[model samples]
Target: MLKNIVLLSILMLSSCSTDRKVSDKVSIMLDVPVSPIKTYFKEHFDFESFIAIETTDSFLVSDIKKIVRSDDNILLLSGNRSVFLIDAHSGKLKVCIDKCGNGPGESKRIIDIAFNEELGQILLYNDFYKLLVFDLKGDFLSEVKVGEMYENVTCRRGEVLFYNKLNGYSCYPYMLKIYNLKNKTWRTVGDDIKIDFPIRSRGLQMVNSKRVWFNAPLDYKLYCFEDDTPAAHYRLDISMAKLSDDLIKKSISDPQTFFNEVSMGKIVYSLNSLRETENFLIFHSNQT
Candidate 1:
């Protein structure tokens, strides 16, 4: 019970460096969808056409994790190992960045990838190993050595923001951090983070225009990295579906038992990814 309280304590209604705190009163109870996902999206979202990427044998993209769009091209991160640049209009593969090594312009392991609008380059993090930059044509540009282990990556112009998650295998403490490409200086947010998230490994950070929005797992507060600092944007109160530490430990060792309990109508909080639009706030929860 005590361990549960200390876990994810960095996101426990503390005021941020921005000195802005969202009211906890603004909570939401999500309703389980009775309808299928296709039906739900069709009814709720506006169709703005579809994109079909041409599959080819040359670029065998497997385990594609993330896709970020530019004005003309889209950058795809696959297996967190390689990056593929594709034409957004033609859906053709433009270039592929998959050089593996410890030498110049190479990555030992890509922790995450994001586009840098300021330099018109791609920032590939080698999991606290190195920061490799490349042009859209897959040409190697430069590298910056970094020592922080961050999972999710997003950038705006000159600032690269990261959502740091200290999992059972990691010891880096900050929940969020910002790296300046010019001077290579750093500013951390939620350095008090010391949570040992066992079930979840990856953290999430979604870029919307100029603001970067993210959420802490099993928690309700929505955070945004705006003005170079972390601010609590929204507090999604699903206090009713409270998470249990005993259940978490049990689920780690015996998932079947946990699923069985949930099948028997056990209410547990297991929300992970978060995304916000101009009008709607979207999230994924385990209850449904």
Candidate 2:
């Protein structure tokens, strides 16, 4: 019930829109007015049933890298070294899969995670192109070998989509690739893209059990995959032309400076994550 309340509250706040422009196109356009954080938080603040995770002997969390909510449980990945499946309501530790070795279901460290709610399984991954599958209870199921090292991954229809976020520095040319488990085949989704994002993020945003949205740290338009192709989902009400070609080129060649410039408001800040309600979508931008 607490998880439900938190979720409801987040969705409720995410529906805020001080201003908007309606559209009848296939891709809906939402214009949200940027308001001050102090006013916004003061207006929507709630002190009921907030969640706080405690550090334990078995689990010492420097940062929660990823999180997925299912039923009354939460699957969390911490610092890409520990994975925990805990009770969402009581905050009790259910299972901590921290097996780091060279065994069959072991890795040097867990780098990423993807939840297939439809399949009811968890995929623990590493940067070396490996997958450690586990059930909801954290039992090791099997190990899978992927062709490329993926920075972000999400599953759909028994297929796992991989985004190679190497920023064109790697040997691989394509940015997005899909691997079908049933057929044991591989296919590229889009053209070669090499821009690297500065902020720490979850590359793909899962919307319900059907849609997934994607955008880089500086990308102008958020994209959704349709028929394995990325289609424009929303226009961020920001001008893409304000971003010069030199900056785009630097995003790949030199990411640190690009991150610095973007942080100092050298250009239009980019949106990172999205939360949706019935009518409006809320985004957390980098600087604003």
Candidate 3:
């Protein structure tokens, strides 16, 4: 009788543990959508009448600051020295400073900024194998290097994927690199992808809670990826102009509740002026 009782207790405990794990995962998922901001922007920010904002004139002082837009925010990389985080919706500059391993005479020399949102971190690749990571606010985290030589870095929400090329004129398949944030390690994935091209433009952006989007410069269009396959494509209309810098700044400040109170299926347009800019533009979207 005691043996049977113990067996029942073990089964109950196992079931309870599984239930707890599932409950915890569901709770976290409920707390935040898989790609809340990205989905909203994709749905709402159509090409017709969008505004742009200048996050920083770092280029004004020098040619160091380059703005790279992620799924939810814009990153200003000052060479490899410092980084600035801009709010995607409002264009407000949140934080700015140097990142990891402080250097007194830093020249701001980062080759690329890749955001692994799932890991809540950013990857900075300096040289072929030299890489560093930091929080969103220029805080030091960790650093590592991989392979022999690679010119660029590409990243998604959970992985920093890279590729390198061979020496000389022969453009052959070299190596494809993958780094895991959970394990904090690097490994080779496949050798079929050539290293002739830099890995800057290739990335996967999460669309909605259950969908993902992919952009390839070679294709020059945005594609929705479902179940690891191409699902939908959005072609640009040439008549629509890009957003002005002023509008981009505003959108960056508060993206979460920025475009609410509008229909989610049809395109809409709006006009707004910025704090210190003259020109005005319209923002059109199917999501608000």
Candidate 4:
């Protein structure tokens, strides 16, 4: 009778255990400050629409060479011999004709532009293998000959991350990059950091302080780099991809309203933006 009772108790416990649900929770911490970003815009030229190159001469002072949108302001590198500081909102030109460095190779190509948000300066690399550093006000700080790497090197999130290509290899290991401004010498992230994807990614982004996200070209995966090392990552599942597609479609459909919404709320920088170009590099911060 005692054996029978014991067997019955064991069966009951097993049934109870089978009825319980198992849930796995992943805790992801965000390091970037989730605060409202106050944007100030000063237009370099008068364009009918905002946040885009205006076709009209009134807005097109020169060619739209390059533009970088940061937390504080927009750095405009135009065809004219200078750069401009535009307010993030209102599109007003806070400072104009702020010349630091000339266009590369007779105005053919402008290499890479890096914004040092902490230092309140923008570093511009030209085709002539020269690096020009300028304050937000457009004041020239210094210019140095940077060699071949200057043309290919790209920065993500200011000076936190830097990337360039390897000689003679355009395929696997076609990329060489580094992180943190304190170090100038570039070191490849890790060995066997293979990204099996289609299109080549542009650059890396500091997703908060601890995590760095890089797009796998032609693939939907976001490669995570932790502590300047390759890490485990995942592709954007269909649902997340759909959500992102919707957001982008909304922006293209109605940029004004979308920009307003982005300005009014906390703007999480898009990982897609970093993938828009082929020369995009990688970056990370220390917060996380």
Q: How would you encode candidate 3's per-residue C-alpha lDDT over 128-234 as one tens digit per residue?
A: 34667777766667777554554345565576655433344222232345566677766553224332222122222222112233332222233333332343244
Clashing pairs in 2: none
Cα lDDT of model 2 by residue, 76-146, tens digit: 88786788776777776788888778787777877677776666788887866787788887888877787
**What TM-scores do the predictions have?**
0.77, 0.73, 0.44, 0.46
Q: Give the Å shift of residue 45 in candidate 3.
A: 9.2
Model 2 poorest 10 in a row by lDDT? 14-23
**Residue 160 lDDT in candidate 1:** 75
Query: What ranking emerges by lDDT with the best candidate at the front?
Result: 1, 2, 4, 3
RMSD of 4: 22.3
Q: Over 4 Å off in model 2, which ranges? A: 1-49, 52-55, 165-175, 181-185, 194-210, 239-241, 250-260
- How big is the RMSD of model 1? 9.9
Top candidate when judged by TM-score against the true structure: 1
- lDDT of each residue in 1-288, candidate 4, tens digit only: 111100000000000111111112232332322442334112221232344322233334455555566664766767635566666654556665433334422223455565777678777666665666666666666665555442233455544333333223222332334434444444455333343222223333323222444443223444555544554354332222222444445554665764565455534323432221132222321111
Clash number by candidate, in order: 0, 0, 36, 19
- The better candidate by TM-score, 1 or 4, is 1
Q: How many backbone clashes does candidate 4 have?
A: 19
Error of 1 at 242 (Å): 3.1
Better of 1 and 2 by lDDT: 1
For each candidate, the alpha-carbon lDDT, in order, equals 0.62, 0.61, 0.41, 0.42
